[model samples]
Structure formats: C-alpha cells, structure tokens
Target: MPQFSRHSRRGRVMIAIGLSALLLGTSACTRLRTHQGYQVDKLLVDSVQPGIDNRASVEGTLGRPSFVSQFGEQDWYYVSRNMRALAFSNPKPVEQTVLRVRFDPAGNVAAVDRMGLEQVAHISPSGDKTPTLGRHRSLFDEIFGNIGAVGAAGMGGGSAGGPGGGPNGS
Candidate 1:
C-alpha cells in the first residue's frame, strides 16, 4: 500500500479544514429575502382620465393590468407587492397595494378604489383559523401576523382569484 508523506497529509488536512470553514461560515450566515416595494400603476391609474375611462381607452392608458375581467367583465386590478425577511419564520408583506377600477356597462368609470397595505388584514395560513386563546400578540407573534395563505383556502385557488378566499381552498 502507498503511504502519504507528511506534507501531503498536512495539505489534505488544510484543504479539508478550509472547505469545512467555508461551509460552516456560509451556513452560519443569515439568509435574507429582499423584495421590491409598491410601485403605482403610473401607466393607467396615474394617467387615466375619468370621463374617457372606456375599456379601450383604459386599456390604452394602463397598457394591461396585473389582471382583468373574467366573468363580469367590468373590473380591473392593479397590484404590487413588497417584502423583507431577515430572521422570521415567514416573509411578511412589508407593503402591498391594489388599485381596483370598476366600470359601468358602457365602460365609463363607475368607481375607483385604492387599497394599501393598511387595508389588508393578516390571517392564518390554515384558512381554517379559529379565534386565538388571547390577543396580547407580541411583535414576533406567529398568529395574526402572516399575510395568510395563497392557494390554501381563503384566497381562492383559481387564476381568477380575488383578494380573499377563493373557490376550492384559498
């Protein structure tokens, strides 16, 4: 059998130590998630003319929304998201905004509502959350903090899902 020399053995040990250090250091480092903030729909919401808010005109004004009509064919939604997660169990929605525009049958602007982050209510992911035992939630409380689940129940699990609970399990 071949035997390793002193220098060769030391070199291998050093390489192993270096690799171990790197792996350990990387693992120790925190994994942070960075997200972009709420950017308004400058194309449509900002430049829209109330009187000229017809379907074609609104489409031209806003280019295309984050979403559009599916069933009723009268509502448009512009959405934006933001998040920052450093040492949390889950990422929180730092900021979120949705611009909802409703049109009359003639396509004239009927109503315009701007919903911001404050308008939303944080819920549980189970989509089956019952009332908690108490309400003295800390800053890092697990409950009453999560932005809720996406396709698990309340938010509706369809492509045409609205803000809250979907059809199957949002």
Candidate 2:
C-alpha cells in the first residue's frame, strides 16, 4: 500500500510539472507590442525643401534617401514603416511614411511632398488584361477564337469533305 501511494505521488508530481510547462509555453507566446521609438530616419527625407537645399546640404541634413529613381536622377523616395502583431494575429502596419523629392533642371531641389496612409487611395486590386480585341493575337485567342487546330477541327463545311479537312485531323 505504501509503495502504491509513493508511485501515485510521483505521477501527480509529473502531471503537475507537465501542466505548468504547457501553461508557461502557451502564455509566453502573447502578442508583443511594437516599440514606438523604433522609427526610421528616412521619414524626414521627403520633407526637404527644394531650391533651399542642394544635394550636399540635403544629404548632410537628412542623410541618404531610401531609394532613387532608376529612369531619372530627378526623383528620390524616402520610405519608412513600422510593423507589429500578436503571436497568431496578422502583423499590422503601425505607421508608414513616404517622401518624394524632385530635382530641377539645375540639379537643385524643385519640389518636395510627404504623404501618409491617409493620402493613399485604397482601390480594389486589378488584374492585367491583355488587349485582344484589336491589338495582338494570344494563345487564348488561338485556342478559343477562330485559330489553331481546335478551331480548325470545329469549322465545318456542312458536308463531310468539300474544302475543309477531316474532322479529327483539321
């Protein structure tokens, strides 16, 4: 009887330990709060006044921008954002800022604009549609329209053989 009691006590201890570990592990995954101080310096870049500051002066004051235009050297973009989320929840953008600075013909700051989330439009996402009406021919047109082997097979001459080929070999 004493041995059984000892064994039961050991089982209870193991169960308690397992439950504690499970609870701690689950609770440890709580959502983490984003640090407000975690800000990027690029947010201030687009705020730079054109004509008032040259490239060197702008760089000295605001540092390098996040990205520059590849097609033209006249535009610069300064972008920064903060993200945060709970353990299982989706990460949400805490903040986002974009700056656009344009240089003039003389390579001096010409215009500067700063936009936040409120300024951006939330339009429904659109998919690309290849213009087939009067533009170019596509595989879809060849398969479904009036081209390709399938269309050729479907085309009938009213009779078995006149000017059209065989039914299966068209």
Candidate 3:
C-alpha cells in the first residue's frame, strides 16, 4: 500500500483550502447591476399633485420621462429595472418598475399609476419552424429544378443573341 507522507498530506490539505477560497471569492464578485431610468425620487413623485401638476411641473420634478406615448402625448412613462447575470449567461431583469402618468386634454396630470415586476410578461416563442407562405419543396426538387434550365433564350446565353448562331444571317 502506498502511504502518503505527513508533509505531502499537509500540502494536499492546503491546496484544497486554497481552491475553496478561490471559488468563494469568485462567487462573491458576482454582483447585480441596476439600470435605472429617470431617477424618480419617491418624495418628489408623491408630491406631484395629479390635477395641479402639468407637463412643466412633472418634467421639473421627475426630469424627462423614459418614454412618451407612441400614439399621442397623453401618457408618459418612467421605467426602472435591475438586471443580474452570472458568468456568460444573459442578464435578466431582477426587478422592474413602470410609472405611468396620464395627462388630460388640458395637459394636466390626470392620473399617476405604477406597475411593479408582477406586471412583467414573459413571451415564449411557439416553435422552431417559421410559418412561410407558398408550397414547400424537397431537397431533391430544389437541386433538380434548375438542372438543365441554366442558359435558355432570354437568360442571356443561348444561340439567339448577336454573338453566335447556326451559320445563318448576322
């Protein structure tokens, strides 16, 4: 039986401890980065009286919105998110908040709404096959379809051009 010396066993223990420390250190370095939108302070947001605050007051309090309504200028949105990722994986949203401010026709703040992560929707694609129009052709059909149809007439390489013909008039 091969017996390990006392020094060799101690060295092995030290190596194992070093590897464990390295793994723990690396894991500790994994941090979540918060990507926030227009930094909307809670106190300022709360102070924004709906009917009193107009576009100018809202802009001054919360700064410009993250996005305005695409259809019209009726709604403004302030969005914030926290994303986390490990190693080479894609960063995913850990938290999301969307504050919607709706304006009445008079351009005054009509309503103030807030949505949390619970409102987030995850959409999964249906399948690998994409729906395409027209009939699908087999590999054999694709390969043989253009076999002898290379240089025909108006295709620019037949015997009806000005370059060469069958011993007839130019």
Candidate 4:
C-alpha cells in the first residue's frame, strides 16, 4: 500500500484546490451566446408565400411579429439577433436579421423581404448638440426672437379682433 506522508497529502490537496479555482476563474472568459427578438427558422421563413398568405396565416405560421410599422404604411417586422458577450461587456450582434412583410389594401401579403446586419445604423453621436444648418441663437434671442418680427409696435396690421383688424377698418 502506497501511504502518502502528511506533507505530500497537504501538497496534493493544495494542488487540487488551485486547479479548481483556475477552472472557475476561466469561466469569466467564456463566450456567452444569446438570442433576442424572433427565433427565425429558414423553413418557416421561406414558407410564407406572398399574394396568398394573409396576416392571420403569417402570424399562425411564424408567430407574432416583433413590431408593426406605425407611419404611412402598415407593415410587420420580425427582428432576430444573435448576440455574443464575454463576462461583463455589452453584447454585440453576431448575426442579425430583419424581415419585413408588407401588406396590400385587403390585408394580403404584398411582399416578403429579409435583410441582415447591413441595415444596422451605427450612429455615434457627434457631440452633445445636434448639428443644424440654422443660425445659432442665445437663450434671450430665442425667447424674444419672434416678438417684434411679425408686427411692429404701431403698425396697422389687420389682425382678427383689434382696430384696423378687418378688411374694412371699422
């Protein structure tokens, strides 16, 4: 029987504890995979046929959409993104897909479009102030800017309810 001495056993125990801590510490560097928004399946996305499928049918097949257009046109958008992150940094998109489904007047599918990360707008703000082509004005100028421009102090401007306000100065 190989019996370990007290010093040898303590050394082995310390080595084991060190290895365990090293394994745990390396977990911080592990790449984390995450998903956001819609989970797209190639088969399901390809199955949606335009001109034949309606909103209900598309919803039934692909589930609820991520967002609906609120402006001039009513369209459905399915946004899917795969993100990767290390321990404590902001997650960056590994893969992103934006699917736009347009509808006709009768609610039938007009078209189906799919796009990738090319649609992403990386807008780093230039500064605290947004750049504009207009002339710069101070707080006092802005507050009293329009006060004297519209009508002079005693000019007979035909206003709605004042004297000389009407077409006939009655």
Top candidate on lDDT is 4
* Per-candidate local distance difference test: 0.72, 0.71, 0.84, 0.89
* lDDT (Cα, tens digit) per residue for candidate 4, span 43-161: 99999999999999999999999999987445999999999999899999999999999999899999999999987899788779868898999999989876757555576664658
| Collision pairs in model 2 | none
Q: Residues 10-54, candidate 1: write the lDDT tens digits.
A: 899999999999998876556665655335756547667566677
Say which prediction, candidate 1 or candidate 4, comes out ahead on lDDT.
Answer: 4
Among all windows of 10 consecutive residues in model 1, the one with the lowest summed lDDT is: 151-160
lDDT of 4 at 15: 100
TM values, all candidates:
0.50, 0.52, 0.67, 0.68
Which of the two, 2 or 3, has more lDDT? Answer: 3
Clashes of 1: 11
Q: Return the top candidate by TM-score.
A: 4
Instruction: Assess candidate 4 and give its lDDT.
Output: 0.89
- Candidate 3 structure quality by residue, lDDT tens digits, 42-138: 8988988889999999998898999999988999999988888775577899878889999999999999999989998889999999899997999
**What is the full ranking by lDDT, best candidate first?**
4, 3, 1, 2
Give the poorly placed runs of model 4, Cα more than 4 Å off: 1-4, 126-170
> In terms of TM-score, which candidate is stronger, 2 or 4?
4
Candidate 2: segments with Cα more than 4 A from true spot: 1-29, 33-47, 120-170
Candidate 3 has which clashing residue pairs, if any? none
